[model samples]
Target: MTARTLVMLAVLAIAAGTGWLSRGWFEDAQRLTALEAAQAAASQALARESVIAGVVEARLATLDTHQRVIDRGVIREIQKPIYRRVCLEPDAVRLLNDAAAGRAPDPADAADPLPDDAAAVE
Candidate 1:
């Protein structure tokens, strides 16, 4: 071929390769923009969840304080010592007398005076 024809062919080939390579660059930029959008959405969702959790925790604390005040008021009203007494009606006593003459009381009727943790140990 002639020198002019060879130079034109070389220029055309370089231009085609550059266009092919820049196509990938454009695709990569589009992918990056989509990823950034997703990350921003996730960050906003996390922030909203955190705010809701904080509000819920604050409300729970207020409820805890209110319950404590009511419990303290009730406990303060009880001044008598703990005691247990069992009295049966006439019909109930007759039934009990017929059932047994002498027998130990049922263990299930015993009052549990221990704290919850101490009872669990037994």
Candidate 2:
């Protein structure tokens, strides 16, 4: 064979080998790009979830404080007036006096209301 023909054959062989190896490299590069894109998407989704969780936590804290204020303020306001009225009733006052004197409550007094007591209840 001529020297030029042998050199041409050698160049063609090297070119074929390079092309075969480079095909796998090109596919790997494409796969790496796809993985990077997927990672970015996942990071964005996590950020959104974190923001939502922060909002929920803040709202829960606000609701908890409001509920505590209602329990302390509104319930106390209602109970104070009701307790005052209860304390002023004749039976309650008598019972409180007897208890202060360390007397046992009269069973008959609790069981049978006087006519005036029944009328006052209405």
| TM-score of every candidate relative to the true structure | 0.49, 0.47
Q: Which ten residues in a row have the lowest lDDT in candidate 1?
A: 78-87
Query: Number of the top candidate by TM-score?
Result: 1
> lDDT per residue, candidate 1, 6-115, as tens digits?
99999999999999999999999999999999999999999999999999998988874333333444445544433221355444555476569776555454454346
Off by over 4 Å in 1: 65-122
How much does each candidate deviate from the true structure in C-alpha RMSD?
A: 20.1, 21.5
- The local lDDT score (0 to 100) that residue 6 gets in candidate 2 is 100
Clashing pairs in 2: none
Clashes of 2: 0
lDDT scores in order? 0.75, 0.85
What is candidate 1's CA lDDT for residue 46? 100
User: How do the residues 67-118 of candidate 2 rate in per-residue lDDT, one tens digit apiece?
Assistant: 3333554543445756676547777778889999999998688744666666
Candidate 2 Cα deviation (angstroms), residue 93: 76
C-alpha lDDT of residue 54 in model 2: 100
Question: Which pairs of residues clash in candidate 1, taking residues 3 or more apart in a chain or in different chains?
Answer: none
